[model samples]
Target: MAKVGRIKLGSQGLEVSAQGLGCRDLSGPGKPEPDMIALVRHAIDIGVTFLDTSDFYGHNANEVFLGKALKEDEVREKVELASKFGVSFADGGNKVDIRGDPEYVRAACEASLKRLDVDCIDVYYQHRVDTRVPIEVTIGELKKLVEEGKIKYIGLSEASPSTIRRAHAIHPITAVQVEWSLWSRDVEEEIVPTCRELGIGIVAYCPLGRGFFSSGAKVAERFSENDPRKRLPRFQPENLEQNNTIFERVSEMAKRKGCTSSQLALAWLHHQGSDVCPIPGTTKIENLNQNIGALSVKLSPQELLGLESFVAADSVKGDRSAIGLATWKESDTPQLSSWVAA
Candidate 1:
């Protein structure tokens, strides 16, 4: 078991492991389910007190899988559960349907609670900004649930800075979920800074760029015909070829530092600030343990700066996302704000 790294979540009373586990991809389409139970349990045994899941991941498959894993003997109390709402599965496939109405908010939370088989959620986040419904009204209903003892904290995911500020004003946002990494530093300027000023924690998803940082996982495999990574611009031929150079350097640094590329990447993200926690998601036990190993690899500011410069110097290869998906929920800057949802 890895030793836990503790940090305060926003202004809330809960303290969690600095490196949490993201459970979305475990049971989602194109992932292996046989590995999820042991993988999640392995995370819990290794000081991963924070576990994040969402209802939209495969039409509630992620939540139901988590429920079964949580029922393991004496494992339920070991983790702090974070679930999300505001995005529903309109069809059985991959499409987000926004529903932030107060009634819908309550209903979504209830469904997530039932799926997770938990009495109260440690953290409940809106999966995305429902531009139709005012964020304040969403918070109003979430706060009502807080008063009702159904929720512990409110969060927003992939929202703009203005939305974050507005939502926080309505209620103290304990944490904001966003895809922030060395590769995805889009949250540095206002979103992350604002969270710091306001004392909210940043839960960095995709800390590994969806397996881009793993030890033996090469960029070439992602370009395979059936792989979804091919659909992402960053994984295109030219972009992938150039980006692999960055990975090469990352691998070199990892060898020099006596760790793997994934560990170095996760360590750097965790060491960025005490308020930031990176929940690098993985479905393989080896990858899960490798990620947790990051808690012990403390990087100095100088090393972090060096890595930043190296990444910047290396051509980013391609845009992180495609046209609409690249937008990441309507932001207009290289750096944008983030909010929470589940």
Candidate 2:
């Protein structure tokens, strides 16, 4: 196997492995605990030193899984652990709410720390931008956590270009986590450029397009009843049928390149720039190994252009997610001078 590489996130000098492990589904209703722990430890053994999880994932169960996975003092020191807050669950995890108030921010951080059983998180993020709260105020509280050693660096997720700038002005943002893939190029419009100019690294989540690009439309039907992607517009039957072109094109390219479609998707993100890192999550070690192999698939300039042109000609047919949900579109806004006016 080729040696896995590492990249520095922004100017904070926080280094993470080139391919981070997204731990959202590692532990869940159907996932076995021992298997999940073994997968995490295996990832570390192979140099995948960055782990991404959210406090809201599995309704706080994911962090607890990590706590058990990395219980050993020496094992915990090998990875750069990142987690997010700002989203709260209600009505038994059916209803979702976004909160960024100073009080909630503090409370959320404390809760995450306890759940993960860690003294401090390496990178803490506001999972979703709360349009009602001023970006400055939200980041200001994070800055205090950094000062007090609760978190080493700050990050934002699904934030707009304007919001990113506003937050960065208050304090340097180490990274911005957003869904960026062949099927999700909206970020390239403004978010990517802004982060580049501001020296903020991008942690691309869902880089496989929620398994759509790799598994094709048929995968949509296999989603569990509770799977969140079932609610996404792109996964609907009509949209999925229309989006088959994307899968076909990517599959063709992967065959020519001698890589799996999933690997091709990840390699595309890798080719974008050194500042972009995609944290592709999976419960199976085979899938994890395939994701890691993406680093080795090189694309020629013509091949890259061909893929881009193919996507441009046969664009994805639906919104990334259902409207009115907490998403990148909802977070795009100019900085507010007062939260009261928002």
Candidate 3:
């Protein structure tokens, strides 16, 4: 078993495993609940101590399941737990609603605490920016929570540079979670630099390009009707054919490096900087072990460039999401005075 190493996230005193385990899609339809619980325990047993989850996943079932998983055998005490709020589903899961009002923030945190059955969350994040509310108001309430010992640290996800600045001004943002992978490099332009400038950590979700870098194009063929990837533009048949070429080139490079494509993709993020942590989620123990192997697969500066050339950010086909889901580029919020006047 490979023992995962620990690193500091942000300038805060918080420290976690070099690579965290994203806790999503583990409690949804067609998923084995018992197996998922076992996977969480197995990950903690192996030193993958940073666990990430969201309230919107499975319509709140993910957090409830995590509560059950952590209660068994004193599992909760062994890891740094993180979860998100501010995003919810409406219209039978067809419409996405984002809320960041002070009232919503406090109520959401209390709900999450009950679901996780924990007294204090290690890190709490606003999952999506609510454009209607001022970032200051949201952070102000979060600051109150910190002082009250409800959450130890604050974080933001899919926030614009301006929104991040405003929120961080009110309270220290320990981390910013975003879609950062070989195929998703847009964050590097602004979000990454802003986080670095503020001494914040970057928690990279979908670090393997939603499993494309790991399983290649064949992974798309396995998507069931319920799978949300089927609706993503990148997975459409037309775009997928073009994107497969990038995967082929990356596959060749991975072979040359004597590592799997997934390991190579993760290793590239590991080389970005010490402040970046990639949380690649997996339901299978075998894949979990394989992802951990990425830690040992070192990459030289020249090799890193070679991998980037194979999948340059712009060369990849299609948007990160279908559209209108409150991504960072569209994450600016209303001004505090404007909201007050309204």
Question: In order, how many clashes per candidate?
Answer: 11, 0, 0
Q: Point out the higher-scoring one by TM-score: 1 or 2.
A: 2
Per-residue error (Å), model 3, residue 163: 0.7
The TM-scores of all predictions, comma-separated, are 0.90, 0.96, 0.97
Q: Rank the candidates by lDDT, best first.
A: 3, 2, 1
Model 2 lDDT per residue over 1-342, tens place? 565799988777899999999999988778989998999988998999899999988889999999889998588899999999999997888889998888889999999999999999999999998878888888989999999999999999999888899899999999999999888888898999999999999999999999886689978878888788998988888887778878998899999899999999999999999998899999999999999999999999998888787677347888887777777777854345534633
Residue lDDT tens for model 1, 147-236: 999999888888788788878888899999888777778788778888888888889998987678773236556455766666777777
Q: Any idea how many clashes model 3 has? A: 0
Error of 3 at 165 (Å): 0.7
| Displacement of the residue 339 alpha carbon in candidate 2, Å | 3.5
> RMSD per prediction, one decimal?
4.3, 1.7, 1.3
Deviation in Å, model 2, residue 102 alpha carbon: 0.7
- Model 3 per-residue lDDT tens digits across residues 180-239: 999999999999999999999999999999989987789998998878888888988889
Cα displacement (angstroms), candidate 2, residue 19, comes to: 0.7
Report the number of the highest-lDDT candidate.
3
Clashing pairs in 2: none
Model 2 bad stretches (over 4 Å): 91-94, 332-336, 340-342
